[model samples]
Target: MALQRKDQDILNAMSLVESTKGELQKLRDNGWDSLMNKVSSFCEKHNAEMLVMEDVFVDPRKPRRKTNITNLHHYKVNCFYTILDLQLQEFNDRFTEVNTDLLICMASLSPLDSFCEFDKEKLVKLVKFYPDDFSYGETLCFEQHLDIYIDNVRRDERFKNLKSLGDLSCLMVKTQKHLAHPLVYRLLKMVLTLPVATASVERCFSAMKLVKTTTRNRIGDQFLSDCLVCYIEKELLDSVTNEKVIERFQMLNERRVVL
Candidate 1:
């Protein structure tokens, strides 16, 4: 939910992920007693029978094995530890070392809080990921530009108290600062395109369900792509008027009739 906020940025998102991992680890290590107490309270309130920790745990469907196991082992090891371990593993799998570093590097470029998070070293490292976007010559130039860009934006009143990357990008363009620091703006553009969370992807899938219904199941890939683009980017599409679209369509080929 923190990651899904409208104003959430890469810096905040990265911090949230890191903090969540730490909290989950702490739970796995020291939360058993606390968790058990809550569960016990809930069970007692609901009139559910609470099993004795020392009692032998019996498998309802399977035949009893020769080896004895207490309810403590069954719940603590198989249920508690197992679930926590799986969650920690999932976090590790999703936010691997490289991915975490990438996020950190990207966060360094954030314009929030007067660009307090800006790090020239991380920005340089970030560009390496996209060699196609930042060539050898451009990369060197970007390092030089970063020094000037950071200094300028930090001192500039227009860049102060910025909320998100989108605001920074817009302000840069509005002030014509993007033209002054082309490489920095280019890197910013690339960073903006990277997906920090699954919210947009989930929205796309939800929109797809509505778009490609049974009646429209046979739609071609190209047509589907066009429809999805317009549907997903409705805000941008809304600005365009029917007459403007007709004018552009007519301009595509010379029309015989003026009307």
Candidate 2:
């Protein structure tokens, strides 16, 4: 849900990532008893038989073998801990130390809260990662520009109400500050184009799942593509009238009767 925010919340990405990891760890450490209690309550409410944790748990697939593991051991160790470990592993793989550092540096460039997160050193460090984009002299120039840009933007009334990096970029161009501070604007443009906005991409995948369900699994590529476009861009779809849709369908082929 945090990833679904329009603001992107880049400034809090690092903290969010860290806190998520912490929560997962906490769950793995002490969540078993709490989980069991919930399961107990659910089973009781449903009038379902509860398993005795102390009872021997036999492997259903290998009943011939002598199995001595308790139901508690099978559920807690094989299922709960294993699932949490896999989740932690995936999280570690996705958000490496380098990725975390880059996100933190990117957050420093956020224009939200009147550029409260603005940091010259971090921005300079961020540019270093894209050596192809910023040469040594250009990097030094960007570092210098940060000093002037942050000071001017923070004091400028136009920038005070900025809610996002996109807003900041447009305001920079609108106020002709981009011309004076081309490098800073260039960095802002770079930041805007970064794939750090995974929320939108995640949302696209989610929309795809809704558009292409099990019943529609065999749908043609073109039809699925059209469905996804309408599903994902609902705001644009809302503007389209039913008459306009019928007109478009009529235009596509000669029907038995034209409406």
Candidate lDDT (C-alpha), each: 0.86, 0.85
Query: TM-scores for all candidates?
Result: 0.71, 0.71
TM-score of 1: 0.71
- Mark the regions of model 1 whose C-alpha exceeds 4 Å error after superposition: 42-48, 63-67, 112-116, 131-141, 151-182, 220-259
Candidate 2 lDDT tens digits, 114-159: 8878888888888898899888899877877888888988888888
Using lDDT as the measure, which candidate wins? 1
Candidate 2 runs further than 4 Å off: 33-55, 205-233, 236-259
In candidate 1 the C-alpha lDDT for residue 61 amounts to 73
Candidate 2 is scored at a TM of 0.71
* lDDT of candidate 1 over 141-164, digit per residue (tens): 788889999999998998898887
- Cα error, candidate 1, residue 229 (Å): 6.3
